[model samples]
Target chain A: MKKLDEITKRMPPEFNDFYRQRIDFIKASIKNYFPDQIDKDFLDRVVGQPSLFEPDLKATYDTIFLPTQEYLGRGGKVLRPVLVAMCLEAYGADIRDFEPVFGAIEVMEDSSIMMDDYIDNSLTRRGGPCGHIAHGYALANVSSCTAFALSHYLFYNNELKLPDDKALKLLDYMAWEHIQMAFGQIEELYWTQSNVNDITVDQYLQETIARCAFLTFRGPMRYAGILADAPPQDIAVLEKIGEYLLVGYHLKGDNLDMSPDSPEWGKVAGEDITTGRRTLLINYLLDKADKQERATIESIISSRTEDEEKKKVVYELVLKYDIFAQTRDLAAEYNQLAKQEIEKLSVSDEYKLLLNQFADYATRRRSL
Target chain B: MLHHLIENFDTEFLEAFEADQRTINECFEAEYKKLSDTEHLEQNVIDEPLLAWDYRAIEPGLLELMDPFMESESHTPLLFFSILRDLGLDPKPYVKASLLLEYSYFALGVIDYFDFHKVFTERKQDLLTYSELTQVRYAAQYLIQYPRYLVIKNSFELSKAQNIALHKLYATIGVTTGIGRGAFLKWGHDYFVSLIREHYFQNSIYTLNNYFLFPAMLGAIIADLSDAQKDSLQKGFSALTMFAKLRLEKRYYENQDEFKITPPIYRDLWQLLSFPGMALMENGLQVDPAPYAEDKYPWFTGLYRDLNTQIQGIDMADTIKTMEKLETELFETFVSELGRVDLLPATVERLRNCYRM
Candidate 1:
């Protein structure tokens, strides 16, 4: 079977600048809003008066935003906001008008990633030390809250002057989606920590729609579609694309995490096995493993074993079953569905091509 | 006088308060059960006995999730109702909001379980039992979002301004909790200054302000008070909250035995102060630096004086007098409308000792 890296597609040169500009725009937006040092003016804006007397402003910034600042500095794809910008362009709106929305989406994504790392006790994120490891766990914990709040603040205080009804709808949508996201995470935790042992690929996909797809895919597209006043049908199309693309994107991530050179891409290879986390590959393996094999896999996962040899054993078993190839094919099917959804949109071919390129970059890219 | 007020709970008033507590607990359990049902959380899984379920292996019960909020000896809900009564407002419509406030407290408690445990064992090799830490930590990730969900879900019952205010209120609660906790972990050698700074900034004042201001802020929003009146209300409550928080801190430090069953952070603070920090501000704690520490390092001396000046400037006698004045001018007439003078002293004490108070 072909390995993941051998089939992995690189971001096209034309699309490289497209992605870079969005990342830069998001980084600039963040810096513009959260000043170098937090002060009364910023505090008054984010959290209104009456201000505290003699607040340790420096301490507040250091404790709250500094870790986030450093983490955002490490730079992921910033694709959620990019997706938002894409939806806006397709709907004939200027992205510049919604800069705060961009900041909100990116910051919320960062906050979730930070919290994920903290919960998983991950050692690294974006190729460096995790926020909790780089900063103290205390700063990381509180910073997550601060960053989450800052995202809402950015959204509410957006300068776009959106109509009240639309604003309210968008706010409610974000909240409901977040609740769905939370439940998805909790359910996944249940499966990870429990002996239920019956999570099918279908069940995992449903969970992924909530856990991975909503925030990463549906949210950005829907935010732009709603803000751009796109018709409900178009919004539905974009949502479908998001759902399919995110499943493909996530399964691709699952496959990549097991690939031998995943470390070159700045993530620990076979980390899913080491952490005993549930993944598409592991689900397939469990379905196929006999009684003894199932017990070994279950024990390794349940114990969250740190032993190198045991992790190697799981890795060998994964190869024995050709699980990575099977998961990769599963991911490709979703990616194809995403492209088909992209084709259904009434936007210009330029927008479609951009989106198709994005899908490729999202699900097929070798690096983070 | 404080003990007299606290110990002598009026029997009729006690009955009324207990009735309120019962009503609130019923609402919490019902809502929680509904939420679990909506989420399809297995009932049998949550109902299994604690010993039978491994903290690491099994998902915690929805019943356990509600336990820290419902079963706590907190008087926040009752005092909130009393304060609403004292303001001449109908408290019935806002019961759900008060319920959300209790859940908000529960959410914070979830975070605090992790925060305090982390701080309590910052330097220890075995920080916490791995399972317990993961369970609580992951619980907080979702639970922290619960109150905000309740607010957004119940938006029809609230005005736009009220909805916005409540959202900001939750965010501020989170930010303040983080700031206060982060301060403790990164507390510098200028310990008192750090502690006092954090307290005023967002630690105690902002944290405790959210609770006192929860009801009052709602009152102001519902009353359509001008921004100035809202600011005035906040200012008044700020001073009161400061005094109340100081009293609570003193009580916390004094009650070392209470630390036995609680998270180790409290005991660790006591040990750290009693040993290396070289100061034990024990009973008869007057918030005076001289009574606690006698360090003569020049920098330390300056910060010590600053801490002393800050504490000394807060004359509790004057605070009490001001509070009495507000009771008469601001609250007495409205409270009289309830025609329950027998409930007054207990209400006053309970209000003083709200969620954090």
Candidate 2:
């Protein structure tokens, strides 16, 4: 696994500098926005009564606040927030003006991940116990519920005090995106729970778009466009760009799941297989493998085999079928398409170049 | 004679009210059929393992459970349609929108029930397996959003502004329910205060207002109702919602087994009921259970009278007396407020029946 610095070093110097500046600000801003602990006075205001017993504070911290920080502190790529700012910049809006809403993206992502991890029964995330495992299901679940509610604070309590019409539109957009996300999760859960293997590439792609793409790129990008009041045509272009980038980004992450050093980068090698996730790679392999090979792959995926030897066999099949190389090409193809979409945008050359660089970084990044 | 309460009212009013019920029930049946169809995924089978427990295999049974459970909460959807019809607007277009609202609220209710019972009671274990609990939750998440897709797909009839209102309505409900659920699970003075501030003071009110007002807002915009008319309708529906929630909670409080109520839980409930109005001022929050609340907020006074009654478990005849008095007073206030509005006679009767007055 590459160090964070090494990953940045691989990016073009200009984009690297741009990414670092905004990424640092996003990280710091998220840190500043989430309170470390709930003080007694803060509790009093929320509870509405004068007398708050001491135990409530401890319970609140244990159930909601602490578990939330533990999960958020594990560090994500902050890709969504960065994309939000970049989209704002493309529209020639001052990203600083919308700083508060950035945490909205982060908390929403954190909240979704915590819930998703629980649903999937994942053991590890970002090289630590999944929230549900680290903090019992009750605490993890309640904390996630809190995070979901608090995600709205960034928009509702924005320092700018957006006009009612605009504010309503933004909130509406977010809700619609969230509803789409739930549909996405339903399909993914159903596919795995049903142990369904013959998932067509289109079926797989649509699920990925709904589950990962919308929240990760499309939603945040459109959110920025709406906030900037970008032209509808440009916003449409941004949406396509986000969709393409997500396809590329998601495929690359799938390939990384089998990398030997995935654990070093806070991923479990073959975790998708064990969880029976119908990734594009798995679907592609299932489609192409011979009768015996298909049977073997099916057996492994359906059983959620934990045997290293069995996982290695699936990895060998991946190589024999050249699935990784095919995935890389597909990812590259999508990344190029994303870059092409960016060219259609009316944004300035610098912003276009930045968007294109990030497009490359979508597939080029070493770690998931 | 009591059952014929609406027979003496205008025929058009009765027809509209019945039509709303029929449409809501139709929507529920449609959603139920779609969810219970077991062959949803036929050709996409991974070689069936020798033994595998599938969540989908039990979906039919779950829907069977969900069907009756949803029917029991039918009043909420009725209230929505009643609000629209009472305001003299067509409730047809927003029937699906009301379905979206219904599923959203019910989904959150299921989550609250599961999460709270998982901690507080072992009784749910008899009713649902761990897998059933989780799978039901996943199904709920799907149920909540499927109607929104229907709304969007059928968007030709809706204006962009109306669509935005629907979105805001769903989002506010989701956020507020999350706050309410979190607050319900955590027991502490601070947690209670936070719950009061976030859930009651802000989120819950926003949610209830949205639920009651979305139809009115859409109807007003469509009918070109004057602002004064809109304001009057809004006040009536909001008041009705407030009273309904208070009544619902009062019933829940009535069912409270004192043996199950621990020290902290008991104390928290007590403080919430007896919280001094001035304490809110000290905390920079004003207590406003107004318009319906005359001297003291009905929430405090209504619950305070029966504070000891809960712990006494109705064993003492005095306990039941206090409880009945509070119930009668709350019902009278609700009926009085209903009278203040310009609702059709049938709409008012439906609400009385729906709220079990």
Candidate 3:
């Protein structure tokens, strides 16, 4: 229920400093890894072209490619790709050499967002019309597939000069992550669609870990491991850390969504409630509410509307139950676990400190 | 007593099988607990109460069907564990492999519940309520997507190539036995009635090949053959298929009157038949025999009598006796081909226990 400014005022100076530095580093890395001019030219030349098979259908290219570029330009945190670069650097890989790989991760993330927004029937993403809304559904669908092809092409034609085996391994890891994420997506679809009320906290954990955590956290970290040829044992540790960190991150996102005054959060607040997404916050509230309160929440969810009044009613119930605090506690627990796992890594102290700080910022950041 | 079939069936394999079964059961128990936890269930309440069944309610009919396999304390994992052990491959990696297979099956069961309900009957409206149907618009989508996740996740143990091959084998079985057969029954149920009424054995046999024999071959491949021996096991699989077909035809004959005369009998018939009878239908046969009445349909009684005559002519008692003998030969042939002479009798006995006919 707290506004972003209020939450920011409550944060310690050191935490703010760490968060600001990370964001700055991420922005600079995006610029360095993918220059603006080259990206535009690449988009124009590759994505902007007419269909190879249907040369006359220039509209297909314009509708699919232009909107994709517009969507990419709308910009996100680029968190996953940043994670890749951080992990690569921590593992002592030359980060500059893996620019294409970083770009591929960003491309994959953007494409997934395009598809997800379409699937969720979301109208706006990052303050702009969703891809399917900007273009048409048919063109958006084609662009989604095109994004994947572009990602694969980036890896296949590795400009990083990775050894043949390492290049293959990188591709394999990317493909594997993509598959795992899709499974998670399917599970999400099942839960949301089925109106399944019996979803437990554990089920929520499993689904989120599969759906969001794998791609957002684990995939990037593991890619870095593969690039650096880190030990399999260390890779395993990274996976656990990724899992915990991502879960915490999702919990925080869920919290931010329920906070009505956080317009800086972008998109829509209470969208999860309106859409009936089975977030940890929703699950927790359902678990804790008494029968009468439970009925009230169920009624709101069943209505499945985005009415401001309905969102306010649900927000009141969430507050009465103290669900936000409980969710934050849970997120803190995971963040702590992630930090513990980070400590187990054989990486340098500086890398460890950076990871711990990032985990803190990831789980606690209130605004850009 | 089951141990007597394999010549050198050691106690370790049994212990290993028991341990793997326990692990898998524990996994399911954990899942079930999450589903059944009142607090969690109460918390998970959505607008659609039925969606809650995703976690909480187990469809009694599906549970009863799955009970034997669930109670048997193993499914594909047990088979994989036993086969991998016999083949001298390390069985450790297969624990995860088996778990993945079980999860895939669990997800498939969820899809099957929706399928049987015809939830997607009105696609546009249903999509509004249950968007998950989009992922599995074609049943083959589940086969392609879910199994690949298992292989990818478990690819740490085997090479990517090996994992793909093994996963493909399982996926193929799912498509052939689950989707392919389910579609056949759904589409051909009316035709099958006409075939039964007219006593069209040749046409029936052709239908049976798709509805029955192919699935039987697939089951045989899963049961008796490894990836390396896929090509070599064709003859063995064919023999097994023939035996399964005859056995099923005999069972159908014995149950023909019940199948034709009583709708409830037909409803229960597939479930009532032991493993061998169901194998013939690829475990997907669901018939409502009510429509094929003698008065309503001209070919009904004649077809019934002809099926009866065919049933009477083949002494199932003798055929089963012959099948038992033939299975022993097939088992021996498979073992010899694998060059695992020591495992021959035990493997055959295991097959015998599994194949009720």
* TM-score comparison, 1 vs 3, better candidate: 1
Distance (Å) between predicted and true CA of A203, model 1?
A: 2.6
> Taking chain A by itself, what TM-score does each prediction score?
0.91, 0.90, 0.84
Candidate 2, which segments miss by more than 4 Å at Cα? A1-7, A31-66, A138-146, A153-172, A260-264, A288-290, A305-309, A366-368, B1-17, B27-73, B88-93, B109-136, B149-165, B188-357
Better of 2 and 3 by DockQ: 2
Candidate 1, DockQ score (0 to 1): 0.22
Compose the digit string of candidate 1's lDDT tens values, residues B44-103.
Answer: 112222112222222352334435433443345665666666566676666666655665
Candidate 2 lDDT at B190 equals 29
Candidate 1 shows a clash count of 1
- What are the per-residue Cα lDDT tens digits for candidate 2 across B46-81? 111212223343354345434534643423455556
lDDT of 2 by residue, A227-340 (tens): 998999988888788888888888888888876443445756787777667777888888889999999998888776567789889999999999998888988988888888
lDDT tens digits, residue span A1-368, model 3: 13323434534454444444454455554444334333323432332111111121122235333555666676566667767766887888876666566666766677667776656656677778887566534335445544444544455445566665566566555545544455455456555554566777766776677566546688778878888888889998998899898889888888887883354565667777666677778778888888987888887876666788988988888899899999899899999999999998889887787788778878887342
Candidate 3, B216-236: lDDT as tens digits:
233333344454455444333
Model 1 ranges with Cα > 4 A deviation = A1-9, A20-23, A260-264, B1-19, B39-70, B86-88, B118-128, B147-149, B188-202, B222-225, B250-357
lDDT of 1 by residue, A1-368 (tens): 13322322266655555665565676687666555677767765675545545565666677677777766777665678878888897889988888777777777887777777765666687778877677645457667766766667755553466665676667766665665566566656666655457776776786677666557687888888999889889888988888888888888878777774454456666667655578768889988888999999988877766677888888888899998889889888988998998998889998888898888878777456
Q: Once model 3 is optimally superposed onto the true structure by TM-score, how far is the C-alpha of residue A60 displaced, in angstroms? A: 5.0
Model 3 misplaced stretches (Cα beyond 4 Å) = A1-60, A156-161, A366-368, B1-144, B147-357
Question: What DockQ does each prediction reach against the true complex?
Answer: 0.22, 0.12, 0.03
